[model samples]
Target chain A: MPSSSSSSAPTPAAPSKMYADDVSVVVVLLDANPFFWSSAASPLPFSSFLSHVLPFLNSVLLMNQMNQLVVIATGRNYCDYIYDSSAPTNRKTGNGKMTALSCDLVAKLEEFVVKDEKLGKGESNGAVMSSLLSGSLSMALCFIQRIFRSGTFHPHPRILCLHGSPDGPEQYVAIMNAIFSAQRSMVPIDSCYIGALNSAFLQQASYITGGVYLKPQLMDGLLQYLTTVFATDLHSRAFLQLPKSVGVDFRASCFCHKKTIDMGYICSVCISIFCKHHKKCLTCGSVFGQAQSDAASETNKRKTIRT
Target chain B: MPEVRIVARNFMDMVASLPAMKLDQLYQNAFICQAIVRSLPPLAKKYVIQMLYVEEVVPGKLIEEWVLPDGSTKYRVAIDRLVQLRIFSETFDRTSGTSYRLNPTFRVNLQKHITIGGVLPREPMSATITVRLPSLEDLEVYAHEQWECFLLQLINSAQSERMTNISPAMMRIFQRGLLTQREKDAPRLTESGFQFLLMDTNAQLWYIIREYILNSEELDIDSADLIAFLLELSFHATGEAYNMNTLDEIQRITIKDLADLGLVKLQQGRKDSWFIPTKLATNLSVSLTDSSARKEGFIVVETNFRMYAYSTSKLHCEILRLFSRIEYQLPNLIVGAITKESLYSAFENGITAEQIVSFLQQNAHPRVAERIPSVPENVTDQIRLWEADLNRVEMTPAHFYDEFPSRDVFEAACDFARECGGLLWEDSKKMRLAVKTEVHMQMREHLRGQR
Candidate 1:
């Protein structure tokens, strides 16, 4: 009711509003991090995750008759298409197609975890990390491009990344590249973080792509948050006044060790981030102080590379 | 004017004609309500969803605020359509105070559909039918074949001989004595049939299905039950066979009828049977205005009026014949030309230039479809001009008067005719004047009153 009364005035010539029924293609990126989920700090338990995600996917699919869904899992070994509605209508004729897809997704995730465990069994505190956001996003973009380039009624695609685990610092460049391409294609990359802290990479992805990034206070209302905030298509999103993000986390992860940093030093030539002073750049192998020892020269170099 | 004919009523229009109480009753059926919501104009559907959970009648001013400043006209139009459908109830309150709300049953039903995914009247098909269900592709083929036969029968295309028989119930519905003569041996195509061919697939489907619903009374199938069943069929999985046992007597009969019509395909199993929804049935609940999705093949129309239709469907070829004269046909290509003779015949058969152009544009080859104006400008305009030529000399109700005694009298009559605003033609050489038939008496009285 804030600007309710004042917004009621009519314009001289009302534009002919058209609510288009363009097909919506949604690619869901699930972070299959076993280590994160097994930890008690995680709000979304693996079991809780399956229940919410499946229903949310179904609801999204049911929202429009022309809607298409593709679910990609970032497993330890590799990223794979877990479920795709565009694939030949489910071959398993006995089970309901949706339930069949759901079971297949569950089985695949379980199999991925078991495989990861076996691979990590030998070493002490061996970590099984598998949140390949970049790979999944690239694949999603390719899939969108393929469908849209040929068809008469190409669907408007949006990617939803459910990030529970930490960011993959190694994929910093790849992730940013994907976000920019997605932004260029008008494909919003919505991210829902269910874990402890905010993901710097995901926050920027959502912001740049004009999609919603939500961190719910109550993990129990994850489905509610998804259906209400993120379920809307690109057209409806225009009219909706979304939850205002207080501030964007503009901090960049260091290129050298893939670690998040504040007040980081950078190599001017390569534009690579470093936690502290280094002679040789790890990214592009650029020698920094060896070439220019003066502090004023270093300041000039940094000034040229201002982001 | 030649002979009074009943204006056609499409399925949606028939539903729109139902009283509020009947609409309320129909809305109680969740599938019917959902289908109505889905098929409504996009703006109207948006309005319905916005008001779905609102507690009370929202003020008209609030509606205006919801859309952009330039969207007020769309808001009003959307509301008007909603009111017509009895989905949105409008209450007058002088100027900006007017308020509206969803019809109670429609709100509850659509809400249940969107939120909880309302329980189906019939349970999901048990394991028995699923094992032997037809593949999606086969179901699609069967459905398409059946629908093609049905259309072929209506137009009495050469392929109608291939069809076994069209159901009497359908025949009764299709033939309303409008332009159709109920002759059995050779069902000649009427002007309406030509116009029907020019309509897009979605519109044709709606027209045919609505005709069925309208004739439901004579067929002894309740209109409400038929609508509810058809709408429910749309929500079901396409190409998946469901247990026929789950359907009641009325639904089972309707399913058989629908299967015959190619909306659904029925597969016989060991113990029982199952009905698999085809694309036609599955698309029933989709937006009626989804014209863009119906782009099947490219029908290329060149500037020289040569038409090349790259389609394998006989139905497409037969429809093309309604406007363009076919020169020859190959396995996957049809060569035709839009000639003056063809255009005149098409125009005479009640096919408007707009419909012909739209049909051409819709079926335009991908290369042509992508062009700014899908059809060549010269061809579209020429077609329109041909149709316009038929209407050039408009008949009017006017009386011609001549031979005034003097120039002043002639001037007076001319003045009277002009003042009446009914003068069709005037000539000073012969001092003749024409006045409308309705105004003739008034003019005569005015002249006498002046005298």
Candidate 2:
């Protein structure tokens, strides 16, 4: 139903007009969170991870000559566009474009990781930091928007988040904003959580955007999971059996405490969540008294029941 | 649209039609394997990639479980296509049930292509030797001009302004399907040729390419090698000049033929010669179903049925003349209208209304292409109605049986013909019945048996 609504909305540049000829544009958000991958408990090494990912990238390009790929490395505090297939290459390498692309991607990713590590060392001694997923998502959305605006033919654009980092509770609002933007644009946000635990934020993002979200049981078979589940273009996904979402965690993080809560007090004017009652809304600065709060809570209770 | 679909299938179908040994041999080349994978159905491509590294045979049930219940139709189609192309080798076992494993050659080659990467046979020539080479835009223009010239030669050799130096061998390829010649008359466009003219450029290119490959044996060329080279050529960067000396004997000849089709542009320097692949050459490996890969549309059709084409090429004018009356032409634009008489003429030439309408829609100007119906509904409807007017009367070849010995015999014959689903007409009073020509022999035998 979301697909139908998004397609029928008459958006200026809707990617919903997918023909067999239309090429897929996948924006890959690679989690370069050094803290997560370098941890002793991590199942796959960073080097082996690249070995798996490079083939997956090649396979995506091999699926269609015109299929476009954009790789973004999401580090602790920043995300950078590392490799773009559409970027014109001036160097005439003896090898094919596929080889050139893989080489460039690995080089760029190494450079990004080195810079991020240096920055992280300066900022915090050895503290764990969440991958800048929200920033990467926003960047991916912006890049897709630019492609849509400069349209010759509308390409099917989707964001592929390959990360193991757990969700950052503080960045809840920004991540949700990116999710809704992706939903509105009908760009599925497929998430392949390579981490040890399930990412609730990504689960909700994939659920909302009608994308496949999978956490492979065996980390060694990451390439298989990516090729079988994530490599499928939007049009072909209609016929494939993708991993189904059992249930989404709809819990909201309170605006004040930045702690995720199942049952929360809603701000009357701004709809901001709070762990406890407040006289004024923190988000919109709208004043609310006891009666107004009671009414808002009553409506929120009904909405919760309906959902 | 059906013609377009046929064109899409022609190249892959040719690949599928190859003998198994040759196909396996062809798969030895990593680029050809990659090309085959690229041309697979979307679901099939996923299956190949999923099983690329897995050495064990997968149960058919496991692959089936990958699709939803509603997607079983697609699942079957995907599996069938894979099997047809020999990408998946199926085996039946008593205990394991049916299982499939990737073809070893295809898997190994594709894996190498993905992991180690494929190297082109020839590297692009240095800029110093190929000084003052054409820019990408110039190469595109040259390719377009060459293709237009070739098509014009197809339409009418004498009418083409430039002497199309297409070799007799190339002309022979077109002759087999598109053109027909009388004893002493100039070769003329056949029914399919007229329809071919209306097809999108990519489809037309595929048709010609398929014909060329089909006729490769006559030229003592192995089609598998030809296909491998063609697919490899597509992997090369467009407008980059590759040294001709690096090619083998068969490839050198094939490149010459491809140059004639404007797939690649040939360039000569003071010391050496090389071939620069144009967009057409680069598009060769692109799956035929990728209609968007074709050039941008240029024809704009209004509700009034007036047409405007913004192409300077004479080929566009000739193709438009097939289905519309060209009122006038400017340096860069042509004005035309779809009239009843022109439609009739087109229909007579075996061009269908749907073909004309689809041609308009496919080549619609970018300004109107975004609309829901690229071609106006009224115009399409009128075109269909005009075609229907020509097809109002039904014609059938039948054998009339009369003067039967008795009413019962005639009634029995009528029932027999009706049962066969070939009864064209029957009249119990006259004791006469007409059966389709195909059923006449059966009817005669049935009557004798009755006797």
Candidate 3:
């Protein structure tokens, strides 16, 4: 028996071969972290990250004719829209308004970070995760709706990047909600923690959204990472090696204390989450007021039986 | 057959979810469409972006002023194409309307794209170094193999070859509707089968996968899963292995077929612990401009109709033999001639002249490809003439009309037929006409009452 393997190295029959010719939509979530950017001006600064990211963005533009890119800046206040090459008005501005807008948005994000860090002391990193998630997501949904509504068919092969940390629980919840929404929309989320000190939310965002999550060790070589791994558009990535994330932190933050934990108690009435020690749920106002007393009595009965 | 139609309709329903535009209208009206499509200039994309957010019609004159005088025509053409494509919406503003604003969708995306200086960087991906998962390679391989197997099934079933190397489950799927099984286990190929074989790899793959997707619904596979898997497969690189455990159940079953077609290699048994994706699998979603695909071009054609293929693989020889009359084969070169007999033989074998010509044109030798006309015009003309010769019996099955109410009625029917491209023959003297399609029959009936 030839055993199938030895039957003359299978020839790549032209007519019988499969070819890649798809358009992938890449949504890059620009971190609105003016705090980390302001704190560091050197090796791992915002400028450094941009220098790394822009080329990868260009590579995606070069990947396929149908490929589209969406940029959303997550910052304080409203999340600003940065870019989407597929949109009609963005393609024809004679005055370079889109570029101006992007520069302005990034600048604004930086300015907010600087202002927030100078005014407040600690734990107030001006990272507005909600705005970023909401803004980028709204744009993506709009684009998708346009695709679905237009009589001519448009295939959406997608890659989404959440680039920084969530500011707090609200931002975390919003980002999580966005991840689920993206999942429902069939958009895969790929996330990067460029200068995130504690971005457990983004890590979960990536995990839930079927996106690749990366935390770079050598922060300076950000571009190399983007190009080699993320730069591979949905089509090109098929033929090129890609890096995969390992050991994701699946922990969630409790709604009561807003602490990241592996296990937590849930309120039966309103589905409010709590990390041990609360008789009544703060979010839902559900009462298990006598739970501690009941537990003590049960333990006392067990002691009596043993005696 | 009805079952197949149902499958096809469901598949189309999924495709219906995407954005749509009439290509003809898009090219004629939108300038931005032309610019982005032909890669005119960075300024064109910029112009489109600026106009997207604004709700006013920027006058054509203002557009002229916005762009440099020398590049005015380019910008105009770009705008024209975009408007034609409906990607850009044009409206005449009644109040101080000097220019056109960009459409909302285009404006939003373009603003976002150009802002970060044209798309956000894909760098510093989350899974960088220190601890990268090893199973991605397996997933990549599994994806490739699954796709290739589908292609091979198309070929083997068409040829009716006794190749059991492919899995039985895949065979059943092919038999089901993905591929129309041969009447017998004979070595002959049918018309549809041969036509499938003559198409370019890209088109062929699309056809097979489309068929596979249509058939997947019957297999209890979610259409979304198929679409996602197909899209995801496009992201894996050739020669790399991916974790098999990462694949969904339907995909796990599909990978076996891919390995059989040389699209990928399976490391172990039914579970397939690790698999390596081949070039075919990795390039499944890539467009022609992709450098890796361009680099793989091995066939070189000559204007004199002499052909030389650089591949030593038997597969190349087999494909070449489909049209070319092979003279001899060497370690690295296979010499062939494009004779009239060979062309007719190919036509008889269900190959079209266009396919043969395109195949040669696509794989033209690097030397010839650099020329202004990749393949000599004479050779192209010859191929077409040969195919034309075979189609000498010009005939169309049509409905005839002899009795007409008046010349006007007959003329009206004739005009409608001409517009529909269905008029085969006509005689104004007898008030008679012949239309080559049934669609015109109803059209003629509608014209009768009006006349």
Candidate 4:
């Protein structure tokens, strides 16, 4: 703000600081779990999902010309960078009405899902349980760090995770790491849960990063949920009366069984969680006496609520 | 206390004043559309994007529903700004409510930009037109060197020998317009010139650029053409030199002139010359650069009234001389003191104390910049006090009259002067009065009528 002018002052306004702002960068993390698309409970088919998401992404880019979009696909055993607008991808469709970006993002997503379906059909039952959500998140963080390193001043970067799979406890540590970094960097992770069940980790991720966590009951209205709740950037989020989750699942997954637990005994040395009290900590190998382990279980049980 | 209305005008104030066709030409260019989009408030940007794909003029009521009911004020402001920029036009009907439609050209251009990205910037330079231009770092240095020299030449005409062929018109825009030039060729700061000197570089550039745009007609170029070309330059790859031969005829001429302002750097190549858009050129349309914020002023002021400026440019030194008494100057340092006499000269030339204080605070050295208040409070207060000294007791042109006929007559005369609205001062105790010079004859005529 310019200093207040005196009585004799003749409207000396500050010259417009036209080119002194940060550009908006959006990283779209599309969850391409083949298992979820094939599931009977899922209302969004792969093609329908792509059709709706493509236009939503188009509107995101069209929202602001300076808004840079990066699409990442997280599949069963793979997380890949689908498309980045920063790189020149001029592969237009038959007609020029739609951007090569929209077409390429859809095509690449299709290829990713098909490739994942083949892999999922193979002798890998464990892959069905996970969608590489943690890996995709870490990759998004790395990409954001790369952008920041390039000296783009505080480009309003955000991550919108169109999640479909249930949270995998095996990748809990990595996901938490990504979540912490996202929190530190002030990049919100908005999660749109269209899956059958609620994802605790995704809820926590959104909550920690101050991003919206919307779980629309009707999967057919995926586009509306995304375009309305998640379309806004960090700046506009200030004024928006966004739909916020009433509660965040705060349960920790114990290291011993790698299970989400309501009550967990912590290893005194490293704070590693365990479903059952152990004399020797499973993570750090620190030994607590049998009596101490018994006492720890007693306190853990006392802390657990009946609900 | 500047008039509150003064703060209401801003950069877009001029754009709104432009003729409808001229403003339409501006929105026709994708770069201008993008630039205008970038300048909008975040909420307004959201409104534009939501309306971008809509087919027809959406009713304002329908558009208002996009945001939450609580965000109505923000929505109103966004629509208002969009209308002011001519991005959205309001349509009215006898039966229906107000509606807004995106300007057709702006809508088409902005849509095209999103679909194809930056249209390869007017076709790629031919493979045969390979020009080895200076590196980005070297180009930035060149820009600064040229810009400082240009500004220095304006301050001290003797420095013109070292400077290159500057646009005489740009020089006149700065000197002949702002400063009063005597027949002998010496220029003194006019009231506005002092204010201009105190402004930050960005404001100074805009001040001059707006003047240039206003004078674009004199240059025989359409104002819209000048605006479109300049805004399009922002889309140019900054530091990555573009072939000069690729520029259109108008751009070819404009690019060379822009080089004088350090907005673009014209490099010499063995085969053909190329132009590298500097940060200044690229940052022309949008206020979104990190470099401009951090790399502006470097001055340190002490409570003792001494000033140390960490600048090697002659431009900085000459600008300091505007309001400070220069003690001495080293290679990369200038030591100066704020004195009553120096400030009086500045105040006399229409420089305000606030401008001077802000100039110091804005340019405070890095060490002092970290402090909450960059400049010491006492110094700012003292500078303001000195300025107040000049205007505290205003001089009025009036005649003093004493020893009136009687108390009743004196009181009646005072009332008459009050009615005429020309009474400067009146002392009822001594029966002395002062009447404005213009009202002197009228009051005298009234007094004769009273007798």
Cα displacement (Å) at residue A244, model 2: 1.7
Q: Rank the candidates by DockQ, best first.
A: 2, 4, 1, 3
Scoring each candidate complex against the real one, what DockQ results?
A: 0.17, 0.45, 0.04, 0.21
List model 2 lDDT by residue over B283-327, tens digit each. Answer: 887745555444578998888989999999888888888789999
- List native contact recovery per candidate, as a fraction of 1: 0.03, 0.65, 0.07, 0.24
* lDDT score for residue B200 of model 1: 55
Lowest summed lDDT across 10 adjacent residues in model 3 chain B is found at B119-128
Q: Against the hidden true structure, what lDDT does model 1 obtain?
A: 0.71
Candidate 3 CAPRI category = incorrect
What's the TM for model 1? 0.81
Which candidate achieves the best TM-score against the true structure? 2
Ranking by lDDT: 2, 4, 1, 3
User: How well is each residue in A50-94 modelled by candidate 2, as lDDT tens digits?
Assistant: 888999998898888889999999999788999888787724332
On a 0 to 100 scale, what is the lDDT of residue B132 in model 1? 59
lDDT of 1 by residue, A95-166 (tens): 332344566667777777777567656757626343667888898889888876875456577889987877
Candidate 3, TM-score of its B chain: 0.52
Better of 2 and 4 by TM-score: 2
Better of 1 and 2 by TM-score: 2
DockQ, Cα level, model 1? 0.17
